[model samples]
Target: MEKQVEAIVEWLRQQLKQSGAKGFVVGVSGGIDSAVVANLIKRAAPENSLGVLLPIYTKPEHMTDSQKVIEKCGIDSLTLDLTESHNVMYSYIQDQLKGKNEFNESTDQLAGANLRARLRMSALYTVATNYNYLVVGTDNAAEWYTGYFTKYGDGGVDILPIVDFTKSEVRELAKYLDVPEEVITKAPSADLWEDQTDEKEMGTTYDRIDAYLGGEEIPEKDKDIIELLHKRSAHKRDPLPQYKRKS
Candidate 1:
């Protein structure tokens, strides 16, 4: 574990030195992934790393946990409340659809949720550009594998360090790094909408995903469902399809 942490720190430093970037800019959601990344990168580039908390109607506990992580990791961060930004965009979209044929009450759930994720990404990039830092992403292997992240939203970033680690593995690493117990124990959620959670939305738990990913035996029924998720989310793991003109 020490070696793994050392390697990550080295990788982060090399990423900055090679790119001539000042440091890492991360969105600290108080989730294990974000906490781990922020801690690791700050250790690598203490003077350059910056953590930004962009809370768009975020839960109170989440904000508190995020603040705890910032203090624990000694990260330089600022809270940019995005509740109004999200509301404005959400309202604009709904109003635009009010007179259109696609108007539907059901659109609010997915539409508004994804918009929040995109808005957060936009804010991260803006800070990255201004500070000449790379926007470090926090998606773990389970989230990436299940396509649990919003396309071009949480998925949009200059660098993703935890993509190779499963959700469970992320928790273990977080513990090793002394991440707050509350952040570690909290149920994983995109928290994009009310009463939403990662396992609930994916219809599977991180334990199951980790078992399957590790090639361990599992019930046939669970295996079938896991396979389906992998197939459905294949596109998310690949480059977006593009059409090229024949030269």
Candidate 2:
């Protein structure tokens, strides 16, 4: 774990130097992915890293967890409440679709979630531009493989430090980095909505998925879930093939 962390840190430092980044701006979602990314930044560039907590009607626990992570990592941070921005967007979208009959509650909610993610990304980018810092992504391999991230939302970033680690590997690295036990033990969630859990929404657990990915025998029921997720999210893993012209 130490070796992996060191390797990633070195890579990050090189990227920062080559890109001439004065510092880093990250969205710490109070989840393991963001926590690990922030920790790595602290390890690599302690003096120049800044963590941002962008909460949009999120639960108090989410803010609490983010505070714990910031405290544990001892990095500079600021909180930006996106409630107003989201509300303005919600109103605009509602008015735009009022007479079209094209939007429903579910669609609105999904759009709202995506908007929140994108707003956070926009804020981070603005900060980066003003401060000459690079925006670090918190996405991991499992989420990327499953298309669990929002396109141009959480997926938009200047750098991704842990894109290759599975969700389980992230937890292991979190422990090795001495992240708060509460964060390490809590259930994984995107916190996009109330009472939502990642595994429950995906209909599979990371342990089983990781085991299957590692070539271990998986139960029939679990295998079905894994296969379904993989199939459905295949588009996220690759771009559409372009047609070639005759030479």
Candidate 3:
């Protein structure tokens, strides 16, 4: 883990040099993945690293943990509460869609959640632009493989440092990086809605995803669910389709 940490830090420096970017900026979500990223960026460029906490109707505890991560990583940080932005945008969209026969409450729920994610992404990019820093992402291997991220939302990032690490591995990295104990132990969530958790939303556990990635035997039911999720989310992992003119 120590070597991995050193290597990742070096890689981040290389990426920064190559992109001509000043440093790294990441959204601190009070989760293990974001906490790890906050630390990595600070190590990569201590002076230039920034951690932005964007809370859109998020729980108070999450904000507290996010602040803890920023302090623990010792990165220059700022808090941008996006709750009003999200509320304004979502409310307008809902009003425009009202009286439309095609509106579905279930779909609207997801759209609302995704809007929050995209709003956060926009805020991060805006801040990154101000400081000429790259916007780092917090998705882990399990989330990447399962496409459990919000497309063009949390998925909209300049770099994904831990995309190769499994969820369990992320926790281990968090430990090595000295992330807050509460943040490390807390149930992983995108905070899309109240009581929402990653595992619960995916209908599968990260343990099973990690085991499957390792080629270890898992329950047949779990294997099926995992495969189905991968299949359904295949588009999320692919390049956008574009029309090609015939040669």
Candidate 4:
């Protein structure tokens, strides 16, 4: 783990040099993945790393945990409360849709939830722009494979530091980085809505995803769920579609 840490730190430095960016900024969601990233960027550029906390209808405990991560990493941090921003933007869209008779109540919940993530993404980019830093993403391998992230939202970032690591591996990295115990042990949640959890939304647990990714045999039901998610989310992992001009 120590060697991996050194390698990642060096890689971050190399990326920064290549991008000509001053540093890196990450949205600290109080989750283990984000916490690990915050620490990593801080190590890579102690003076240049920034942790932005964008809370939109988020739980109070999540904010507290985010603070713990910032303090633990001793990274420069800023907090932006986007609750009102999200409410107004979503409400306006809902109203516009209703007026056009295009509002679908069945998909409303998901729309609002994804709006929160996109809002955070915009806020982080805004701050990063001011600092001339790249926005770092916190998606782990399990989340990446499952397409469990919001496109152009949480998935919209300049770089993903831990996208190759599984959930368990991320937790181990968190521990190695001396991340706060509470943040490390808390159930993983995107905090997109009230009382929402990652496992609940995915219909499966990270343990199962880790096992599947490890090439270990799992139950047929679990395998089906994982494979279906991957198939459905293939678009998210693939490059943007392009039009071809041919003779």
The candidate maximizing lDDT is 4
lDDT of each: 0.88, 0.88, 0.93, 0.94
lDDT of 2 at 114: 83
lDDT of 3 at 196: 93
Model 4 C-alpha lDDT per residue in residues 1-247, reported as the tens digit of each score: 8988998899999999999999999999989999999999999999999999999878889999999999989999999999999889999999999999999999999999989999999999999999999999999999999999999999999988889999999998999999999999999999988899999999999999999999999899889999999999999999999999998
- Tell me the spans in candidate 3 whose CA falls farther than 4 Å from its real position: none
TM for every model, in the order presented, reads 0.96, 0.92, 0.98, 0.99
Please give, for residues 1-247, the per-residue lDDT of candidate 3 as tens digits: 9999999999999999899999989999999999999999999999999999999889999999999998888999999999999999988878777857556787987999999999999999999999999999999999999899999999999989999999999989999999999999999999999989999999889999999999999999989989998998899889999999999
Q: List, residue by residue over 43-82, the lDDT tens digit for candidate 1.
A: 9999988999989889898889999999999999988999
In model 3, the clashing pairs are: none
Clashes of each: 0, 0, 0, 0
> Where does candidate 4 stray beyond 4 Å?
none
Give the Å shift of residue 199 in candidate 2: 0.8
- Cα error, residue 204 of model 1, in Å, equals 0.6
Give per-model CA RMSD: 1.2, 1.9, 0.9, 0.7
Report how far off residue 75 is in candidate 3 (Å).
0.8
Candidate 2 per-residue lDDT, tens place, 1-247, comes to 9899999999999988899998888999888989999999988889999999999989999899999999999999989899999899888889888869776876877888888889999999988898899999988777776678877788889898888888899999999998888888888988878877889888888887778877899899988877777788776667777899999
- The candidate that wins on TM-score is 4
Residue pairs in steric clash, candidate 4? none
